[model samples]
Target: MRLNIKITFFFLFITKVCLAQDWMQTPIPGIGNIEFPSDPEIFDQNGVLIYKLENDDAFYLVSIAQTDPSYNAEIEANLEEYYEGQLEGVEEASGGTVTFKQDIGIDGVSAIDARISGVANPELPSLLFKRFVYVNSFNVSAEFRPKKTDELEFTALKDQFFNSLQLDVSALGSSIVVDEVNGEKDAFKKGYEIGYVIGRIAFWVFLVIIAILVFYFIIRLLRPKKKKEPKATASKPVTKQKIECTNCGKSNSTEAKYCSQCGYTLPRD
Candidate 1:
C-alpha cells in the first residue's frame, strides 16, 4: 500500500511542471484563457497541455488535467483523506525531507498549499513552493519560485502568482482553465510564508555547519603540536670527611681539634 502511494505521488510530481506572467490575457481555446508574465514553454502531451515560465533566478509552471468522475465518489466519502493522499504523494515524489501543508481556497475553489524543501535535486533552490486546486472535473496546479534575493520581494512575487490564478469552467463546461486575474494582490498566509522562510534558513544553516566542520579539520591537519622537554634532576650535597692525624695516627673530622680515641690535636689545613 505504501509503495503504491509513493508511485502515485511520483507520477503526479513529474507530470505537473507547469506558473505566472504578464498582464497579457491569452485565450487557451478549448481549455480557457490565462495571464502570463511572458510567453512560456508550452508542451502538448496527448490531450493535456503544460506551461512553464522561468528565468535565471525564478521559475513558474502550471498544468490542468481532467479527473475521472468515478473518483468523485471516493472524494466525497473522505475529502480530508483524499487531500492528505495528494499531499503525501507530492512529498514522496519530490524526495523532500520536510513539508508544510495547509488547506487553501482559490476564489471558492478548494486547494492545498504544499511548501517543500530538501528535494533530491540539489540544483533546485531552497524556496520551492506550490499549490494544487481540485475541481469537480479537473485538477489545476501551479508552482512559484522567485528571482529576487530579498525575502520580501520573493514573498511578493509568490503572492502575485497565487492570487493571479483564475479558473474558468465555462470554457469546456466541466473542464478548468485560467480565466483572468489582476488587482489587489492577495497575500500568502503568514504561517505559510514563515514555513517557506524556515525552509530556506534550514538549508543555509546546514551549509554553514558543513563549512565549519571542514575548516576545523583543515586547521587540525595543518597546525603543528609542541613536544615537551625532559626535566633535569637535582644532585645531593657532599658531607665533610674525617682526617687522620700523622702524629698519632688517629682518625678525626676535618673540623675537629682532636680525635676522641687518642686526644690528638688536628692540624689546620
Candidate 2:
C-alpha cells in the first residue's frame, strides 16, 4: 500500500512539472501578446515589457518599444544599422561572431535579421538569432539562442518565435517615416528653409522701399524757399521857380532881390 502511495505521489509530481513547462499566451497592454514558455521572466521598464525565456541549451529575450519621433525621418537609414547601432554592446558582451545579416520587409513594415555565434561566458559558445521589426511608431526586437552551453543552432527556434509574433496594428500607431531628398531633410525642413529665405528677401525689399521714401522726403525738406519781390512806387515831379533871371528880364520889380543872368540873390518865400 505504501509503495502504491509513493508511486502515485511521484506521478503527480511529474505531472506538475510538465504543466509548469507548458506554453501560455499573455497580452501586453499597449502592445500585443505572444505564446511564450510558461513562467517566463517578465520585466516592465517605463511601460515596456522585457520578456525572457530560458532552457538548458539557449535563451531568448523579447522587447517592444515606440520609435522616437525625432528619428522618424531617418527610419530607413536607422533600419540599415543592425550591428554597430542598435546592437552596439552585444558583440562586446557575448564575444559573438556574426554569421548572417539581412534587411527584409513584411506588409510595408521594415526589419533587420541577423545570426551570431559566440561564447557568452567561459563555459559555453552560444548561437543567437536576432530580429528587429519596425511597425509604424513601434519597434519590436527578439533575440533567440539555442542552448546556453551547447552548439549554436538557430533555424528551428527562429521560426518558432517569428511565427508566433502577433502585433496589434492599432497599438503601433501610424508610420512615422518621411521621404527626404537630402540627408534627413524632409518636406517640413525644406519648407522652413525656403520660407526663411523668402522672408529675408521680403525684409530687404521693404527696407529698400523705406529707404527710397526717406530719401525723397529728405530732398523735399532740404530745398531752398523763393523770396517775394518789393512793389514799385511813383516819384513826384519837381517845380521850377519863375523868379529866376528876373534881374535880366526887365520886369524884375516885384520884390526881386537878384536875378539869374547877373549874380544876384533870390527872394525867400
Candidate 3:
C-alpha cells in the first residue's frame, strides 16, 4: 500500500509540473503586474493583496501593499532600517532564520533580497528565496519556497517570477512639479532656473570640446608627410688635360711646352 501511494503521488507531482508550463501575466490593482507559471489563487489578508501559486514541490507568493502616507517619510529617511524590520517580521512569521541578505535595487527603487532556512517543520518548505521592493508609498514582496534548494525547476521559476514584475509608475503620483511663469519667482525657483541653465551650458561646452579634439586628430592623421630629397654628391677632382704631339703622335701634358719622347711642341691650355 505504501508503494502504491508513492506511485500515485509521483504521478500527481508530474501532472502539476506539466500543467504549470503555461505561464500567465497577472496585474494587481493599485500595484503592478507580474507573471505566474500557473493561475494564482489571490487573497486579501487585511489590507495586503496576496497572489499565491502552489504545487507539490514548491509554493510561490507575491504580496503588495499601499502603505500609509504617514510612514512614507520614515521609510524614506532610513530604507535599510525599514527593511531590517521587514526581515525580522518574515523570520518571526515563518519560524525560520534568514541565512543571507543582500541589498538590491529594482528600477532605481531600494529593495532587499534574502534567503531563509530552518523552518520549524521539516515537512514544510525549509528553504525560501524572497525579495522586497519599496517604491514611493508602495511595498512589494515576492517569495519562492521549495522543499529542496537544489531543484533546477524551482530556481528557474523563482528567477522568472522575480524578473517579470513591472511596477506601474503612473499609479504612483509625483510629489513636485514646477511650471514656467513670467512673474517674479521665489528664491528656490530662481535658484533652480539658474542651475538648470548652467548645467545646459556646461553640457554643450563639453560636447564642443570633444568635437574639436576629434577634428584635430583626424586632420593630423590625414595630412601628407613631406618627402626627403637625396643629398648632392661631391664632384670628381679635375685631372690635368693631355695634349697630343704632332711630331711622333705622343701624348703630352697641358703644362708641357714640348713632348718628352719626340721633343714636339705642345699647345698651352
Q: All predictions: root-mean-square deviation over Cα?
A: 17.6, 31.6, 19.8
**Order by TM-score, highest first:** 3, 1, 2
Supply the global lDDT for candidate 2.
0.60
RMSD in angstroms, candidate 2?
31.6
**Candidate 2, residue 219: CA error in Å?**
99
Q: How well does model 3 score by local distance difference test?
A: 0.73
The reply for model 3, stretches above 4 Å from the true place, is 1-21, 148-151, 173-269
Best by lDDT: 3
Which regions of candidate 1 are displaced past 4 Å? 1-22, 26-34, 170-269
Of the pair 1 and 3, which is ahead by TM-score? 3
- The candidate that wins on TM-score is 3
Would you estimate the TM-scores of all the predictions?
0.51, 0.47, 0.54
Tens digits of per-residue lDDT for model 2, 53-99 = 78664676788667676776677565666334665556666788767
Clashes within 3 Å, all models in order: 10, 5, 0
True lDDT of residue 26, candidate 2 = 46
Q: Write the per-residue lDDT of candidate 3 for residues 1-113, one digit (tens) a residue.
A: 45445545665665565445456666654555688766677666776667889876578899877778788888978999999999999999889999999997776677888
Model 2, residue 243: C-alpha shift (Å): 99
